[model samples]
Target: MLETYRGTYFHPRTQFITIDKTGKVIESDNILFPLKKGDEISSINPFFEGLASYFDSKEDNDIKFTCVHLESKKKQQHTCDIEFKTFANGQPSLVIIHDFSDHYEYYQEVAQSRNESVINSQILELQNKYLKEKEDFKNTFIANFSHELRNPLTGVTAFCSVLQKTDMSLEQQDYVEVIKSSGDHLKNMIGDILEMSKIEVGKLTIDEELFDFHKLIEMLAFTYTVKAKQKNIEFEVDFDDKIPKYIEGDKTRIKQVFENLLENAFKFTTTGKVTFTIKENQRRARKVNLNISVKDTGIGIPSEKLDIIFNSFTQLDVTQKYSGTGLGLSIVKGLVELMDGKITVESEENVGSIFKMNINFKYPINQENTSLENKLDIEYKNSLSKEKYNILLAEDSELAQMAVLKILSQEGHFYLDIISNGEDVIESVIHNEYDLILMDIRMPGTHGDELTKMIRSLPVQNCKTIPILALTANLYDDDKKRYKKMGMNDIIEKPFDETTLLSKIYKHLK
Candidate 1:
C-alpha cells in the first residue's frame, strides 16, 4: 500500500507531515518543501502560524485553511487547501495539503455552458413570437382586401343583370354579355385566391349536411350544358340510378370540386366532347363510396407535369394562354383530402386527360323520401300569408344599396327600408316594426355584431326576437363562426344572387 501510494502523482503533490507537541517537525514527506526533523512547522509558510497556535492551545479539533505556494525557479504559483488534526491525547499529530487548481477550472466551464443554454432558449422563444405576429398581420390584410373588392363587385354584376333586362340591339346585347362574362371570371379568380389562403393557414373545415344527390347533379348538368354550347362542344352527364336520394356531406364543397373539374375540361376542350360521370363504386351498411370522373378530349398535360399539377400556383400552360389563377386543382385536392377521399389523374399531351376521384358519404338516417320539388312547393304554400313583410337593410355602400333595391323591387311582397349606419339601424328598429334585418358586418360608427347584441338587449317587442342576417364579404370560417356567436340569426355573403338572397329571406321570415 505504501509503495502504490508513493508511485502515484497525487501522493507527492499532496504532502503529509508529523509534528510534536511543541510544533517541531518529527517526520516529513519532504516532497513539497524540504524540512529537517528539528525544524519548526511555522518557519516554512506563514499560513501555518494559525496551526501552531492551535497546537499550543492543546486543541483536538480538525482545522482547514487555504494557502498559495510560490515556485522560485519556474516563477509559477499553486493554490492549495490544508487540513490539520491532533492525536487522542490533545497533541498535534499530522497535517495534509491538497491541490485545488483543476477543480476551479471545472466549475468555470460548467457555469459558461449553463449561460449559453439559457441564451439559446431565449432566442428561440423570440423567433416563435415574431412568426405568430407576422401570420396574424397577413390574415388581417387579406380579409380587409376581400371586403373592399367584393362590395364593388356586387354592384357591377347586379347592375349588369338590370341592364340585360331592358330592350337593346343584338350587338349591344353581345357587348353586355362580354362585360358580364369578364366580371364573372374575375369573381371566380378572387374566390380561388381566398380559398387557397384558407387552406394554407389550416383554417378551412368541412360542414356536412343532408342534400339531394340527383338535384345537385341536375343543377350541374344545366350549368355545363350552357358552357358546352357556347364553345361548340358536346357535354354529357352519366349519373347512376342506384344512388340514394339523400346523403350526408358538405354539399357546397362537393359542388365546388365538380365545378373546378368541369371548368378545366371546358376551358381546354374546344374541338371535342367533355363528359362527367358518377357511379356507385361500393356499398356497405349505411355507407356508400362514389366514383366520379371528368373526361375531356383537350390539350392534355405532359407526363412530367402530372406529379406537380395539384401543387399550389402550378400551371402547365407557361405561355399564359389560359385565364386562371392555377389554384383550382390545388383547392380541389385540399377539399377532397379533407373529406377523407382520394383523387387521381391520367393524361397524354395533345391527346386527352381524365381526372377521377372517390368519396364516401353516409346514408342519411330518418330522411324522408319526398322529392325536392314537392318539398319546395309545400314550403312555398305555407309561406303565403295575408300580411306584408317589412324588411330593414343596413348597408353603408351606396352601390350595394342600389343593387339590393333593384333586386327586392321585383318580388313585390315586402316593404323595404334602408339605413346607412348602426345608429340609424338602432333608431329605426326601436321606432318601427321589421320582420327581418339584413345588417352589413362592417360599417361606420359601429359594427354589425355589436349592433346585433344591442338590438337583442332592447326593450322593444320585435327587437329581441326579430331575425338578423349578417351581410359580409369576409367569408373565412372563423369570421362566420364569430358572426353567429355574436347573436346573428344567420349569414348572407356579399355578391349573392337573387335566388340565394330570396331563399334565405324566406327561410328566416317563415
Candidate 2:
C-alpha cells in the first residue's frame, strides 16, 4: 500500500513494514517521522489522540472527527469514524477508520448558521419563564386582594341581614357569630398585608412610646379566653414579676403581635390547652428583653416545612382550610426583626406547637392603669347610651346583617332596624326617626350611593342630616371620598373593629 500511495507505514504492534499490491511485505521501510507524507500512518496517530480526549469529555458517545492536512505540507487530510469493535467476550478487537472530510466541511458551515437559531431558542425560553411568573404573581395578587376585601364586606353584610331576619334558628345565630369572627380575622389579615408591604418597602415607621406590657398580656389572654371558650380549649398566661410592667415600643403593634400569636394558638387547639408565658431578661444593662411564648396543643407543623412558614405566601398547610393568607408568620418575622428581636418555634405532629419571641427594649415605669372591669363598665355604659338611638341599617346580605346585629347586641345595644335593600330605605327613613343610618354600598334594589344621594335631596331636613355611615368592603381612599361626596357622614371598611364602629357612632351621635 505504501508503494502504490507514495506514503510510509508502520506496524503499531512491532516494526515498520510496507505492503505492495502483490501482497509482498517490504520490511525496514521509512518510518516517515521528519517529513509529512501523504497517506502516512504516523501523521494520523496524533489526530486520534486529540479526538479521544474530545470524545471522552462529552456526555454522549455519538460524535465525529475530521482532520485537514494542508497540501503545502504535501500531506493528505481526512475525516474519519473511529470505531472500537469488541469480541463476544467484550474485549476490544479492532478500530475501523472511515474517512469523511468533505462531508464534515460541508456540515461545519451548516453548524455555524445553526448557532443563531440556538441563541433565539434560548431567548424564547427565558421569555416564557418570565411570562409564567408574571401570570402567577397576578393570580396571587388578585386572590389576596379579593379575600382581604370580601372578608370584612361579608361580615358587614351578614350582620346587618341577621338583625332583619327575626326568625333565625340557633344554628343560624351561631353562623352569624362565625361570620363576624371570620370578618375580624380577615380585617386583621388586611392590616398585616399593609404592614408587610410597608416593611418590605422600608416604610413601616414605629411609634415608640411607654405602655404597660402586663396589662397588654392580660388583655390578650382575656380576648383569647372568649375564643378559646367557644372551642372548649383551656387557655393560660403565666407572667413572672421580674418582667417589666411597662415597655417602650409601639403599643398597638405589640398588641397586634400578641393577638396574632394568641389567635394562632387558639385556632389550632380545638380541645387542648393553650398557654402564654412571659419572662424578663436583663441580659444587657439599660435594656430588658421581654421573652414571651405561646404554646398550643394542636396539629403541629411537619419538621421539613417548619422553616418556610415564616416566608411570605408559604402556608404550613397549603390546603387553606384553616383560613389564612400565609402572611401571618411573615409579618410576625418582619415585625420581630424590626424590633430587633428573634423568634423561634418548636413543633411536633399531632402533639402541639410552641413559639418563643424576645423583644429587647428600654423598660417603662409600672403605674396604675385602668382595670379590666372599669374599662368594661365604661364601654357598657357608653353602649347602653347608644341603645337609645334608632339605627336604620341598609344591607343586602343576611349573613352580614346577623354579624353586625350580634356585635351590637354583644355590646348591649338594642335600638337598630335592618333592611336588605336600598329601595325602601327612603320610606323607612321617612317613617322612622333614625339617629344614624348604617349603609352598605352594594345593595340589591338601588345601590348605596344613589340611595344616599336621594336621601340627601329630600327636603325633610333633620332626618336627612342624620349621620349616614357607609359600611363597605372596599378600602381604597377613593371609595371613602366617593361615599363622602354622596352624603355619607363617615365610612367604615368591612371587618371593621367593633370599638371603631361604636366610636364613629358616638362621634356622630354626640
How high is the lDDT of residue 189 in model 1?
83
Instruction: List, residue by residue over 106-125, the lDDT tens digit for candidate 2.
Output: 98789988997899999999
Prediction 2 TM-score vs. true: 0.48
Best by lDDT: 1
Error of 2 at 468 (Å): 12
Worst 10 residues of 1 by lDDT: 69-78
Q: Which regions of candidate 2 deviate over 4 angstroms?
A: 1-144, 151-158, 161-175, 178-205, 223-234, 267-273, 283-286, 297-299, 317-325, 349-351, 362-491, 497-499, 508-510
Candidate 1 per-residue C-alpha lDDT over 226-285 given as tens digits, one digit per residue, 9 for 90 to 100:
989889999999999888888888999999999999999998997988999999998888
Kindly give the number of clashing pairs for every candidate: 0, 19
Q: How do the predictions measure up, each by TM-score?
A: 0.74, 0.48
